[model samples]
Each structure stands twice: as structure tokens, then as C-alpha cells.
Target: MKHLTDNTLNEYLDHTSDERSRKSVKDHLNGCDACQTKLEELGKIFAELQIVPEVALKHDLTPGIMTRLNLETPVRIWTRTFAAQAGVASGVLYWLASQLIPFVKIPQVSLSKAVFELQSWFAQLLTIQVSLPTWQIPDIASLLPKFNYQAPTINLPFSTVHVISLTVTVIFLWVVANFILLRSRPQVQR
Candidate 1:
């Protein structure tokens, strides 16, 4: 007859033992003082485990942050505007300089002369006499009409009439476009 084992005693304490095992442990506990004392110690240990508080970590994070942004600094608008104007002026000057500069010509043999030379060489190679015909091109500048201009008298208000005509044309086009857009829109069903 073996006395109550540690596992059986633990199971009995936890109320998980079968009826027969439970009765056997109870009977053994009633006769043994040592097993009863051990069970009381285990109960006290389990109760003490319930009272111990869990510790949480607290960190000082200010030292790890090495830099901060300065939000109070103001932007200089005049400096930026000056820089933009200087860039635009420089670009315009460069463009004007390029346009004013004369183009450089490279020394090259003319294509027409080269073609004539090639034909002459081919004729010499074949020992055949080739004679190219020359035709005279007539100048048409002498036939054009010549105009002699005397300054017109500023009697008519032509500039005012021109401005009025342009304004009327623009207004007419705008009205036509608006009418077309209005006619093309989808109608709602009643």
C-alpha cells in the first residue's frame, strides 16, 4: 500500500482526482500529518503568487532626440524675386547674343561641281565624248510694278473704326459660341 504520491496529492488539492483516488488520498491524509502539512504549504505558495504585482517599464526619451526644427525663421521674398529676375535676364541676354552672332561656314567642295567632275571622270573612263548643254535663265525683277508713295492726309478716324470693328467681331463670335453650347446641352425629362 503506497502512501499518497506528490502527483496524486496535487491532483487531490486541485479537485481533479477520481472518486476512488480522492477517497484514498483523504484516507491517507487523515492518517499522515506530513502530507497535510505539505498541502497547506502548497496552498499558501499559490495564494502568495496571486498578490505579487507586475512591474511596468518607464523610459526618459528626451536625451535620445538630438535635434529640433526652428519654425520662427522668416523667408526673404525680395531675394527670391531678385534671383528669378536675374535668371530670366541672363537667359534673354544669352538668346539675344546667339541671334546677333554670325554663323561660321566650313570649307567644303560644292555638290554641283563634284557631280560634274564625277561625270567627266566616267566619260574619260569609257572614252566617250559627253557635252552638257548650257541654258540662260532670265531675270524677272525688271517686270514687277513699282510704287511711289506720298504720305496720306490724316483726315479720317480709321483707328477708331478699326477698334470698333474688332470689338463687334469678338462679341459676335462669343454670342454664337454661347448659343451653340446652350442648344447642345441635354434636356431634363418631366
Candidate 2:
């Protein structure tokens, strides 16, 4: 006769075994002294576990666990102030560009001529004997101590390079301001 397994004996002691398993375990235990002793030991263990008090958790751990497992999605929050600032900045940049265009002296030149000039300029810069114009401002004397009279002037041909530089400056400022605002915004995750 084969003796019942410890699991089957434990299940029988706990009254959790199926009818067929209960009958088989009971029949084996009744005839087998070893299985009966093992069942008694398991019964004592179960009784001890029942006497021990269950402890309550201090905090809910579902959110932390879910976040660690990447099961939760993060939400980005944009403030009203950030949105307003961005809008104002965009409007200012647009206004500045529009107002400055009429003031800038851009000579009417054909597309082919402009491209040729740009290429020739690059060639001139690359050559050892670069002949770019240099601006010299006259020194101003201090007429009044409080006012400190000063005159500074810069003269250069406003070409494609100047336009590109202005455009790049505006773009850089926009990118930097937006980046700062984005970092300041809050992010929430469940």
C-alpha cells in the first residue's frame, strides 16, 4: 500500500480536499501510521498559524509597485501662466521681426546674383588674403560727468548673413524660453 503525500494529508486535515481525495486520504491514514503522524504534525502547525495575529499595512503599496513595473502613465500639466508667457513671447517676436524688416536696408538683388555673392564671400573668407570691411568708431570725450557723453557706431553691409543671424537669434531665444518653461511645469504619475 502506497502512503498518502504530505500535501494530501494537509488538505485532508484542513477539510479542503475533494470528496474523492478525502476518501482516499482517510482510507490511507486509517491503515497507515506514518501518514497519520504527518497529518497530526501539519494540523499542529496550522493551529499555531491561526493563533498568530495578522498585521495591517502602514501604507498602500499598489501605486509604488505599479510605477516600478511601468504599468502607470505619467500626465503633463501646463499652467495658465506658462501658456500666457509663451503666447506673449511669440507675439513679441512676431511684432519685432515685422517692425524691424521695414527699417533694415536689404538691397533688391536677383536670386542668382545673391547666391553668387554668397559663394564668392565664402571663397574670400577661405582664402589667406580675406578682404572683409572693418568698422572704426571715433572716441568720444566726456563733456559732462553725469551724462558721460559717448558715441559708438557700427557700419556693415546687411547681407544674407545678417538676416540669417537675426533669424537664428530669435529661434534660439524662443527655444531657450520654452525649454525653461517646460522644465518648470509639473508632471504627475499614478
Candidate 3:
């Protein structure tokens, strides 16, 4: 059997060879020591090529990143506030236009006249009952069916203590927020 050439060995090892060529290469490698040694050397070279080192980043990028973030935050806040104000103004204008439009009002009918008109309409469709049912006392015990009852299990962890703690926290935070806002707001001068 002829031994596999370097080119044929490489094609076989790289999985680019046809079945007949691959079988020929395998058969040659089984008998030929020199071809087997060459294959082993190629395998070692591929193994060495597969090993990759973790690369360390070289630059201090924090200051540049912080500058970009700081620049973006204020512009984002201003745009959001402007959009919100524009939306509110548009809604107010729409509401005002709807309310002030002269042709939209229905004639002012009194409550008694409206009720009488509704009753008349009902009378035309069907007879109206203007009386209430007479009330009678029922035997309260007989009215209800008796059953073996179990008390409901309420598994509340922090009841009054939790509520009080939450209230105190909310109040403290509100006071702190208000103080911050007051300090930050520009004072109007006379």
C-alpha cells in the first residue's frame, strides 16, 4: 500500500477528503511509521494553535464613560420634562375646547320634569309600580343553615408594628425629600 502524501494526510486530518481518499490515508497510516509520525506532528501543531491566551485590556476608560453618562442624563431629563409639559398643555387645550364649544349643549330639563317624562315613557311601554314592599320579621336562626365552622387562619407577620414602621419611614423620607427640594429650589427675591 502506498503511504499518504503530506497533502493527502492534511486533507484527511482536516475532514476535507472523500471517503475513498480518507480510507486510503487511514490504511497507509496504519502500516507506515513515518506517515504516522508526520500525522502526530500535525496534530500537535493544531493542538498548539487551539490554545488562546486571555488578553488584558490596556486603557483606563472610566473617566471617559462617566463624562458621557453625566452629559446624557441631564439632556434625557430635560427632554422628558418638556415632553410631559407639552402633553399636559395639549390635553388641557383639548378639554377647554370641548367644554367651551357652543353647539354641544343639550337643553336644560329639570329633574322632576325628566323623571315625569321617563315615567310617561315607561307607562307607554309597560305599567309602572310606584309602591314599596311591606317588610316582615323573619326567624333569623331558621333562615340560615347550620354547619361545622372552622375559624379562618390569618398568617400576618408584622401587623401593627409593620404599619407603624412603614408610616415612620415614609414620613421621614418625605421630610428629607421636601427639605432637599426646598434647598435646591431658587428663592424668589422682591
**Rank list by lDDT:** 2, 3, 1
In candidate 3, residue 9 scores what lDDT? 73
Q: What C-alpha lDDT does candidate 2 achieve relative to the native structure?
A: 0.70
Best by TM-score: 2
lDDT: worst 10-residue window of model 2: 140-149
TM-score of every prediction relative to native? 0.27, 0.36, 0.30
Work out how many backbone clashes candidate 1 has.
Answer: 0
The lDDT per prediction is 0.65, 0.70, 0.69
Which segments of candidate 3 are over 4 A away from where they belong? 60-190
What TM-score would you give candidate 3 relative to the actual structure? Answer: 0.30
lDDT for 87 in candidate 2 is: 90
Note the residue pairs that clash in candidate 3: none
The residue-by-residue lDDT of candidate 2 on 102-160, one tens digit each, is 66555566788767766765665455343444674433232212321223333345799
Residue 26's lDDT in candidate 3: 81
Steric collisions counted per model: 0, 0, 0
Model with the higher TM-score, candidate 1 or 3: 3
lDDT of 1 by residue, 62-158 (tens): 5543222123334444565457767876997899667544443333657787677667656655653334455744443443333222332334345
